[model samples]
Target: MEAATKPKLRVATTSLAGCFGCHMSFLDIDERLFDLVKLVEFDRSPLTDIKHCGPCDIGIIEGGLCNAENVHVLREFRANCKTLIAIGACAVNGGLPAQRNHLSLASILEEVYHAQHGLVDGFIPNDPELPLPLDKVHPIHEVVKVDYFIPGCPPSGDAIWKVLTDLLAGREPELGHGLIHYD
Candidate 1:
């Protein structure tokens, strides 16, 4: 009997408690991205209208979970995706958002818009729909078992391309360490 042909890999990417800059960086791959599309298919991502996790082989998460919603999304992705990659410093180490975590979320909000800025007329509603306070902006590994991480303030398009290529080729995606990461 012949072995079944491996399915073309499906991919999904999402951002959590981040600026969505890394997702833009991924699109900045441009024409080079065309090469990757041939091998893999994109599913649920902020870039796509698709809102829920479908069948996916790889999940590329670009930010850290800073709230209850983020945690829910991460867990959903983890449950669905075969391999999970944490992309960018925010996802890898919480990035700049971690800085604000020094103070309570309410305090930070008040300091920024109410006290110092003097927006007393404005109300800061701590609604359930709003993101919950983060104890700290932790890396993806802190929340879940991430299969891989590409750590950078924002990883370059070339680096993202290389990671995909290496993984597709069935080799360890050597996205460098320290300086030339994954080169």
Candidate 2:
């Protein structure tokens, strides 16, 4: 009965190959946040990460796919998250950093270390846990099918809140277009 007593919205948010600005923006909901705590439980995210994605009513994913780990996480998110939402430009079109796709890996490294920073060390440690940078960054949809998308480099806090609340009520979030388009 307690299970039914609690609001039945379970939500999880994860950050992939992008900065955590999107997640931080979601946190900026401030006073409105406790409302979600009563209605929805966060299953995985930097905020309340229990490691695994777990099963949830909705999944909010920020960032793009850049390497093997990203592919694995994105797929897992797709499997566990019932209503998956791709949050931010990184999830939509790989974002600005993805522009590196236009250049070679060696060029990128050389520029970052040898040319720009003028560092002698460009060697990578061969730790098993460390991820090797991929040839390019990729949008989440490129790797998995997404149920919805919230566009913006880092979507406004109001945007994230509206989506979550609407989804919780089993209503289709009214997506405003022009400057903003919910996918």
Clashes counted in candidate 1 amount to: 5
The Cα error of candidate 2 at residue 53, in Å, is 1.0
Candidate 1 local Cα displacement, residue 111, angstroms: 1.3
* Worst 10 contiguous positions by lDDT, candidate 2: 174-183
Score residue 110 of candidate 1 by CA lDDT. Answer: 74
Predicted structure with the largest lDDT when compared to the true one:
2
Q: How far is candidate 2 from the true structure (C-alpha RMSD, Å)?
A: 2.8
**lDDT tens digits by residue: candidate 1, 1-183:** 111255568999999877887888788799977777767778998767999888688999988878788888898999999999999888888888888767777787677767775575766667777777566677778878999888776888777878888888888988565424421
lDDT tens digits, residues 1-183, model 2? 353596667788888897998988898898899877777777888877489888888888899987788888888889998888999999988987789998998787767756765467765345789777779999988878898888987888888888877777779976586437532
For model 1, what is the alpha-carbon lDDT of residue 94? 82
Model 1 worst lDDT run, 10 consecutive residues: 174-183
Q: TM-scores of all models?
A: 0.88, 0.88
